[model samples]
Target: MSDQIKVKLPDGSVKEVSKGTTALDIAKGISPRLADAALAAKVAPLPHNGDQPEARLVDLTRPLEEDSELKLLTDRDPEALEVYRHSSAHLLAAAVLDLFPETKLGHGPSTENGFFYDFYRQTPFTPEDLEKIEKRMQELVKEDVPYAREFLPREESLERFKTEGDFMKCHFIEQFTKPDEKISIYKTGKFLDFCRGPHIPSTGKIKAFKLLNIAGAYWLGDEKNPQLQRIYGTSFFSKKDMDEYFAKLEEAKKRDHRVLGKQLDLFSIQELAGPGLIFWHPKGGIIRKEMEDWMREEYLKRGYSLVVTPHVARTDLWKISGHTGYYKQNFFTPMELDDAEYMLKPMNCPGHVLIYRDQLRSYRDLPMRLGEMGTVYRYERSGVMHGLLRVRGFTQDDAHIFCTPSQIEDEISGCIDFAISVLHTYGFNEFKVELSEWDPNDRKSFIGTDEQWNLAQGSLKKVLDARGIPYKSMPGEAAFYGPKIDVKLVDAIGRLWQLSTVQFDFTLPQRFELEYVGEDGKRHQPLMVHRALYGSIERFFGVLIEHYAGAFPVWLSPVQTVLVPIGEKHLEYANKVGDVLKAKGIRVEVDGRNEKMNAKIREHALQKVPFILVVGDKEAEATSVNVRTRGKDKTETVPLDSFVERIEKLIAEKKPTLD
Candidate 1:
């Protein structure tokens, strides 16, 4: 072994340093400012074979043991923020332990937006407890408590946690560590935790942090186990960033779909009916009708045959589709009927597959596109279900395309185009695409021959490349049956929602023995592409609710216009105008109640009606109406025909704004 190791910097510079020199030493050697600003380090070992391994985060104080490519992460690095937040979680746990020594610790980890630490105690943590913990965390930050790391024999570590009655920690230690291996531990102040950490140096590095709230979580997500209090919090490198995050959080609260769903009279989850099952009210149903009608029309224009299938099928069908073996956990419990087991369909793919295999297909019918707005049922845990985002029963705008090998690329490109059109029509102008490929070595997780995976993945890549679309290649995110392309859209609030997918499935066709007669007069398996544009209608509706903040586009609004008569004398004219709109296929409502005109206008404005038409003596006589457009203060009197024409154009063009 050499007495010195080589450290390569990201700028392609290498320096020879003594073996076991820490990253902090290298940072200081580069510049004092760099060293002072550094929060953590990333190191990738340069093996003798000259292949560089994936870089992993590490503490600045940790010694570099091999020739490695090193990058010091500071506040500028997004990766460093995750490490900072994780360290903040440790600080939170330490504060909890300081105030309540009897509380047993569970795992603490960083989430996409923040971090959370779980604790088990006889009493649940209160809001006041969170405030005290925050104060204690601030004190610890001032003290500059180091996040000290150490390792001990697995048996000794387990025994220590067992002695302290930390059953959760003991369970984690046993589950994650081998019997003879050493276990990694971190200590922040007086709190010790079983963790494999690459944390920021100390508590002082967490500049701006806040304890958000506490939520109940069953240990290991099993209802049979004891519940733990999970403390949620967020941390940022600067106070300015933290303030901006809180501001966005407040905006998100106002746009929360659950609250707006009730206020807008859109949709609801009835406690008596179920948790995840959604009931579309009259207003919501109208919007859904518009959505479905648009989709079905597009399907026909795109040369897809609309199809519908049964909601329940024999378990034998699932067995043939490989869902019985691979996806049984997500399946609703099977029911017995006529001495045969039946199960609710968790996906629409198998039904489409059956339809395709029903008749022998020829090469001329190579690309058979079948689309459906099918509802499927799945068993979701109670705690995991959200309003409409995560649900048990939802409708998918699903389609399946069975194409020949020669037509695979064209079919994929068509699907991509269709997906982009869906996004554009839904008022989403920004989107990201990801290509998910299978891990070749993970045979147990992914099915199909290597050739099948390569061909399918290559076709998808070719289509993307031809269209000049950039996509992230995500390994191991592929479905068990095949590789896929996922399209995520950025909402108005800059949040990404997974909206569309184009998946290549080869295993299901083989499992079901689906064959088509090729031009060679021989039977061959057709390539199958599974796609969903909306992903889920219910979830898409939820996203729309938040994205528009309950103010839908003119075309999609349940009631396009509401007429408020100035007085009882004008009630007949209001009805007359509403009748004209209705004849033109416009969804119009006439408020003929004996109420003040301003009060009626206010009520319709609260409902987010696109246009509130006021009919009075002038409007009734001139065949005109005063329009109070949503989101606008001024009222304008326009001829009734002219107003109707403008609204018709807005609805026909699907304008996102009323003006």
Candidate 2:
């Protein structure tokens, strides 16, 4: 065997190096600046060989034992950014250990926007402690301590961790490492951790970072186990980027739905009634009614038959639908009944399936669409639950289209049109579409023949292409039964909300034995298209609240116009104005509270009322009212009839803004 190994650079340059030379050595040979900038190297064997030809990230100092292709990673690469944040987490751990030697380490992984590390300590870490920890981390960064990796016998590693009373580490060792395996350990200064890591060369790479906050997490996520202190933090390649991120975070805080929800008195989740269950207050209920009314009207206009299904079904139904096998982790336990086990519905597709199979279908019924505003329940983990975004129970604007293969393209196109209409009507102008197709290599994760998958995926692609819409192709993101298109709308703050989907299904029809007679007099299985425009009503409401910053349009606002009388003397005139607006089918409220005129206007504005009409003696006598619109600084005095006509026209059009 040749003692020299060939190292292929990403730019097509090759270098001859001694077998034991490391990637860092090659980088140094190229340039000292490159060697300093690189955080890690992604290396794969040369000749482009192996069942998995994917390169794996490793420390730059990792020895190259054979011919390989190497790509050095820096802050410019997203993957290296993840590694940088992970190293920041390691620095956090090292800092914590330096400050408190008694603390035992748990896992620390890089999250989407930041990183969090778990630690087991007797004393709870206070805000002051977090500050001290951050201070000490800076000192470690200045030291530029090397992160040395070492291999130890599994038994020795376990014994070492056990000797230090690191029960968490010992448990991880026993759980992950085999008896004859050599456990990889990473040591940063005096802080040693049992981990297989591709960390940066040193701690100095972690330049811009901060300890955000702390929360309690159950050990291994088990309630019965000890709760560990999970410290959250974020890191960036530069100070400017970190500053920009925090600025966006501050803006997000201002638009937070939970805060606005209470301020606007729109919705609430009561504790006694349990979590993830929303009780829409009067104001919120009004908006929800408009939402439901619009949806139902569209259902009729689009030729879809409205249907209602039971909230619970027999466990056998779920079993036959393949949900019991596919989504077992998300299913709630079955309720024991006198006849059989019953289950809360987790989805509405099966209910529609049963409805379609309720009668004989002829070729004329080639395209049957059934729609429902169905409430469903799923078993969500406690820690994973967020406001309305993730909840145990939700109402879905779900519909199912049963059609023949010949009519699939038109049906899919119609669904896309409906979805886009919903977005545009709701004032969402920006959105991203994704086509999720099955992964052929991972056959077990999917449930369909190759022919069925190809046909379904081809139909979705062709429709999108024919419409000239650009979409991201996401492999391995399809539902087990078939492929799908997911539409995510970008809100005002630029956060993407997953709100619509059109999914194809071949397995469900076969499982339910659904059939329709064709023109050729042959019974054939029908194709199923599951479409949900709003995803979940509660979640969509939350998005709406944040999207418009609680300032709804004239049609959707709970109190379209609040008549604020300047004093008790004008109360009669205010009442008259409210009556006139009420007669015209407008939602009007009279603010006759014993408060100052400015206070009344401010209060109504706080509630995000569309119009705050102040009627005084002069205005009342002139048959006009002073109007203060939401999100406007200047007030306009207009004839009561003129204002009514204007708002009525706005409401009729469902305009997104006053102007």
Candidate 3:
């Protein structure tokens, strides 16, 4: 066997080194500065038979025993930050063990923003205990203890953990490793963990980290298992970055939809009505009306026929649609009615399909677009019910199109165009698109033949490519029934929300046996496409609240104008002005209560009213008023007619800002 192996760098440079040399040695040979900044190394062994293996992250100390491609990851790489955060989680566990020796470790993994570690103990951890753990973590960092890795026989490792009262570790070992194989472990000081790790060299590498909070989680996510305490934390490469992150978090808290919803009296979730069910208040209902009206008008303009479907149907319908087999878990409990079982609809597709199949369609009536603002219900677990973003019941602006194979591309392109329009109308300018395709190797997980899958995916790609739109292709992320295109929008705080989707379902058409008479005088199956622009009305409303920070634009504000009378004598003129605005289709409210004008103005301003008009003797006699526009510091006096015209124009044009 050769004693030397070749290491290829990302820049296409290669170097021959001893087989036992480590990645850290290679980095040091390049430069001391590079070695100091390295956090982890990604290595891929050279292909043997024209097949390339995926590159994997490993410890810098891992020995390279074969010809490989190596890339040393530093602070600049996002993947390195993930590894750094995972190592920080281990440090957290070590600190916990130092303070409370009886704590049993579960698992620690990095999340999108930070890391979390689960621990099982009889006594719950207090805030004060967290503070002590954080301080001990600092001490460990000061000591710069090395993260040592070792492996042992699987049975021996499991027996050691079982004797030490670490049942969770034993469970993990038994579940993840074979009895005859070795198990990987990591040790820091006296703290040991059964982990498959590629951690940073030592605790000192974790410079900026904070323990955020703790929550209760069931073991393995089962309600019947013992509950464990999950502690959350975050780490960053630099202090400046950490500070910026916290600042953004503070802003996000201030803009939380739940807080703003109560302050503005928009929406609520009543405990008596049960969880995940929303009750839209009077103020919120006005906004919803506007949203629905706009969407319905667009449907008519786009040549779609509006339809309504029953909220509940027989279980036999779901069984035929295959929802009973794949999506039964998410369905609410079935109800027995008249010796037959019934269930609330979790989707609107089957109902629309039934309508299309009611009559034989011809080629001349090919593209039948059915649209509905249908409300559906699903059973969401108690722990997963978020504010409006996640709920048990919601309305979907769903539409389905049945067309010929030759016309499928145009239909998809049209759906994309409509989705873009929805984003623009809702004041969102930035968006991302993802095309999820099925996996050929996983035949059992996905439906449809190769020809159908290829045709559907190719049509979606052609539409996006022809329009010069950039998208990420995600293989193996498609639904069991078909492939789909998802559109996610970036909100005001730079958070992504899933807003729209256009999916291709060849399975449903076949399952329902939908057909149309073709131009060749033969019966052929119609292609089906399902699209939802505003994924859910409740979720979209929540996004709107956060995006505008409760200060809606002039077109969408519940109260477009509020008139405040300076004195009792001016009430008549205030009402006159309000009536005039109301006649022009503006949502106007007159503050005729016995109160000071400035106080009334301040109250309405707090409600985020778009326009506050103060009418007094001087302004009333001149037929003018003082206008205080939202988000503006200065007040301007303009004639009532001119103010009405300007606001009318703003509302008519659907402007995103008052100015």
User: How many backbone collisions does model 2 have?
Assistant: 0
List, residue by residue over 1-659, the lDDT tens digit for candidate 3: 89999999999999999998999999999999999999899999977799988789999999999999999999999989999999999999999999999999999999899999999999999999999999999999999988989999998998899988999999999999887888999999888999898999888888899999999989998889889999999999988889989998998898889999999999999999999999999999999999999999999999899999999999999999998888899999999999799999999999999999999999999799999999999999887898999999999999999999999999999999999999999899999999999999999889899999999999999999999999988989998888999999999988899989999999899999999999999999999999999999999999999999999888889999999988999999999999899999999999999977788888999999999999898899899999999989999999999999999999988999987
Best by lDDT: 3
TM-score leader: 1
> Which lDDT tens digits does candidate 1 get at residues 573-659?
999999999999999999998887788888889889999998889999899999988999898999988998999999899888887
Q: Write the per-residue lDDT of candidate 2 for residues 191-297, one digit (tens) a residue.
A: 99988888999998887998999999999889899999999999999999999889988988888888998998888889999888888899999999999999999
- Model 2 residue 388 distance off true place after TM-score fit, in angstroms: 2.8
Candidate 2 stretches with Cα past 4 Å from truth are: 1-37, 40-73, 148-184, 326-338, 381-384, 433-446, 454-478, 617-622
On the 0 to 100 scale, the lDDT of residue 636 in model 1 is 98
Kindly report which residue stretches of model 1 are placed more than 4 angstroms away from their true locations once superposed: 1-8, 12-18, 46-52, 465-468
- Report how far off residue 121 is in candidate 3 (Å): 1.6
TM-score of 3: 0.93
| TM-score of predicted structure 2 | 0.86
Please estimate how well model 2 matches the true structure, expressed as its whole-model Cα lDDT.
0.92
TM-score of each: 0.94, 0.86, 0.93
Candidate 3 positional error at 183, Å = 2.1
lDDT of each candidate versus the true structure: 0.93, 0.92, 0.94
